[model samples]
Target: MSEDAIQAAARALSAGRLVILPTETVYGLAADAGNPEAVAAIFEAKGRPRFNPLIAHVATAAAAERLAVFDDAARALAQAFWPGPLTIVAPARADGGVCDLARAGLDSVAVRVPGHPVARAVLAAFAGPVVAPSANRSGRPSPTTFADALEETGPSAAAALDGGPCDVGVESTVVSVLDGRIALLRPGAVTRDQIEALVGPLPADQDGAGEGHRSPGRLTLHYAPEAPVRINAQGASDGEILLGFGPGVGDPRWTLSATGDLREAATNLFRLLREADREHPVGIAVSPVPMLELGEAINDRLRRAAGFVG
Candidate 1:
């Protein structure tokens, strides 16, 4: 949060070292997108597969334009949602300078202009594209606070910026605008309705695993905890930690939202999972979250956390 800290992180990044920077969604393990070795360190630190592409965080729309060819829909979405949690995937410009490793050697790149001031400041200070994925080991819950990030991957990073907890508490909604069509890649705080309002109805969700990796967050069994997770439970059995949604679950350890506000539940989702996993319970059972608005994103994360697929 300090100017000195930002400067130090900028310097480290300029020197091709990793820095854990906070975003509105989650803390990210950031490296120079143009530096292959620096970007490689992120994979090494998180144990992430090379085929999973990274999101390139930029300072402005112009910066993003420099990296990818924006179509009509992509431009409009960027104008409306840049500086927020909406990632746009577009064809990488032939001259786009992002490293091959960061893009997974694909012709497209997932890029965003984050809303978090600390993250924006770091991007501006570094003055280039930063490939930052969630700052946690692969298949683990993402860190929403500085303390959790430190516990997760701090030793591998040169420095970490403490910017408090993330406001969104989930990854950005990723939409790929390719070949004159818009496809929802991932859901987040930005609802499908919002994107549809601007770009018309979206095509079916893109299968990154089947088609190829054009964006991040496509792994089947990701964002998981050490404890087995069971979703849509009416109640938790003995020895299991209950994560309730609409309350009335009889003194649950963590309630996503006692009032049943999906937004509030989304904000608390990852932090609660991290907390519950720390207890080393027999298992974690969660109440059903409505399949609407932010709930879609919350459930997406929960499903992945439970390792239901892949």
Candidate 2:
């Protein structure tokens, strides 16, 4: 990481400007969590709704504790998965300086310590919590590379830190540890089985799905592409692009993983989606991915991308 780049990003963030920072999962459209105006810029830049909250990325577990009151379970999960892709949603500290706009005016706040070195350096340099959603336009595929991030959010941001491609290539696994019970809000690279081993069986749907937004990625139509999407497809329609997995019938425009490696497929998911969508196809058809491990996260994104309700 360049010191000049880090300093420039820190300066922009301190000046209440947006910065595109990379994480282990995906690049984020970052803003100072304590600044309401900065947080509002994120919403306006992405055309995102106010009801959807953003994840506050901190430098360390101690930093996260300052923003949210963690219970024993929350602490265990944090200790086991901090500086990683696990986002813990806990009760917000009443005195915590996170602005209401960043949390969508919710009593609870979603916090995480990113594992990316560049992100950590920027956070440490900024010396404050930074709330960042995926560095893309609202309802668009999350950018996995800094180049892609710059292409998506650059014009709207003050600067972007290039950290290459995201390793995990998916959002963090979000769990709400509030209300004394562990609820799985959104599945990502951190498998439910891994979380369950630590916190016991999680509730089926603990996320409050009503009016108020408890966490990000809860929106019905999100992570969408420009073209219409169709899932569980064995092949593509006449003018559609087929995004295939494993073996397939006709020639696919792109393949998530020809070898059927879920991890490889996960890494390629957004990149391939963005590629296929660039063609301006009539629609994008996706082959069925097994509902296991990283596949769950893939399917979750696919379902939302296709605008499926249930």
Candidate 3:
């Protein structure tokens, strides 16, 4: 919340430079959305596929409205989840003020109003849209800390806004509305059930894997870690160590929240991943947990970190 830091970040964005900014979910590499050249810098910096697109970060609902055409459904979702981890993809009006390239050449632009004070401050000062995605090299783990981003993105970033750790520690839930239907492209803090409760039953596959279905976050091989890690329940071999969610039965490499609570597990997942990387084990295994509940997101991250198919 430093005014100096906010001013420095605003200047970077206006000058067509990349700035690492924090959000509720993860740190993002931000560039001016109205400038195609600035937006292109993000793609080049991350090596991100142009087809994948980027999210436009805004300071308020008014700012977001200037970027895309929002229907009633899109407005409902925004009102309920704005300033949090949610991105709604709707058709970009021909007169939409954002750059078309920022939407990956699609008719819609992904937009969100971040909850972090520093991020909000930057957006307000810039007084325009900021196109951003996870602040890491393409296909690497999303950075939760400024130090980690510096390691990957390097000093090319004009400034890095240190917002401490991301609370959600993942990407936003992306809901796309096209052709008069609601689709969920990716799932995160917002669940399908929650969306359904408000909007009726949503399409099972929002990314369109099959007929009338669209897939979100279904991309194979994502959310990876720098080190070898695993999920195990009992003790481990000489090289392999235990990441215990319960009492450590014997010699161990690391034990996390031995009480085994899912909420605790989610909060500790990245920290443990970092610790495991530092230990540099050949592999780190997690104890198996039920997949129907909190275990779902936990396993999602672990599988992503381990580079295993989820």
Candidate 4:
């Protein structure tokens, strides 16, 4: 990590200017969470809807507690999953600096302690909550690499830091620990099984219209590419590029994983989506990925990208 780059990003955030910061999952369009005008700049820059909230990144679990009211279950989850790709949504503290615009006018705030050293350093240097959404335009694929992220949001950003290609390559798994209950809000690198092992079984995804205020990724047609997408495709159609999974799929250039590894597939998901669009295929066909564990997050992204979420 370049100390100068980290300090520059932190200074940008402190001055209420938009900056791009890298995380394990994706690069983010970051702003000072306590500054409404700064947070509003993010909404304007991305053309993101006001209804969709943003996730506030903190330096540590202790920093997270200052923003949200956590119960025992929430604490347990945080102790086990913090410093990683998991966002805990809970009641907001009256003095928590996250502004109303950043919270999408909800009483709850979506907060996380990122594991990426760059993000962590910026948070500590900025010494406050920062709201960071994917560094891309609304309804587009999240950028996993610095070049792609800068291309999408660089013109709007005042400063940018490259933490290299994101290893996780998907957004954080969002779970609401509000009111002493744990409910799945959105799937990402962290799977449901991992959470269940720590805090007992979690219910199905609670990211519906009624519960949308509490999560950032509840949109119906998010992570979309310019070209239309076809899901569960065993093979490609005419003028379509196949993003394959298992063996015999043939197109290694676009293959997520020939050996059927879910982790590799997840890491490559958004990158391939971006590349396939660049190829200007009439449509993009996707190989069937099993809906289990990490696959749940992969399928969720594919469904939204295809604009056919249920």
| Residue pairs whose backbone atoms clash in candidate 1 | none
Residue-wise C-alpha lDDT for candidate 3, range 104-194, written one tens digit per residue:
6776778889898889999999998897788887766677776777776756588888888877776777788766788767766666677
Runs of candidate 2 exceeding 4 Å displacement? 206-212, 248-253
On lDDT, the leading prediction is 4
Candidate 4 lDDT for residue 91:
93
Q: Of 1 and 4, which scores higher on lDDT?
A: 4
RMSD of model 1 against the true structure? 1.5
C-alpha displacement of 238 in model 1, angstroms?
Answer: 2.4
Using TM-score as the measure, which candidate wins?
4
Give me the runs in candidate 1 sitting further than 4 Å from their true place: 208-212, 250-252
- Model 3 — TM-score against the truth? 0.86
Alpha carbon deviation, residue 132, candidate 2 (Å): 0.8
Q: After superposition, how far is residue 23 of candidate 1 from its true place, in Å?
A: 0.4
Q: What is the TM-score of each candidate against the true structure?
A: 0.97, 0.96, 0.86, 0.98
| Model 2: lDDT of residue 110 | 94
Candidate 1, residues 133-174, lDDT tens digits: the string is 999999998889999999989999998999998999999999
Alpha-carbon shift of residue 226 in model 3 (angstroms): 3.7
lDDT of each: 0.89, 0.89, 0.73, 0.90
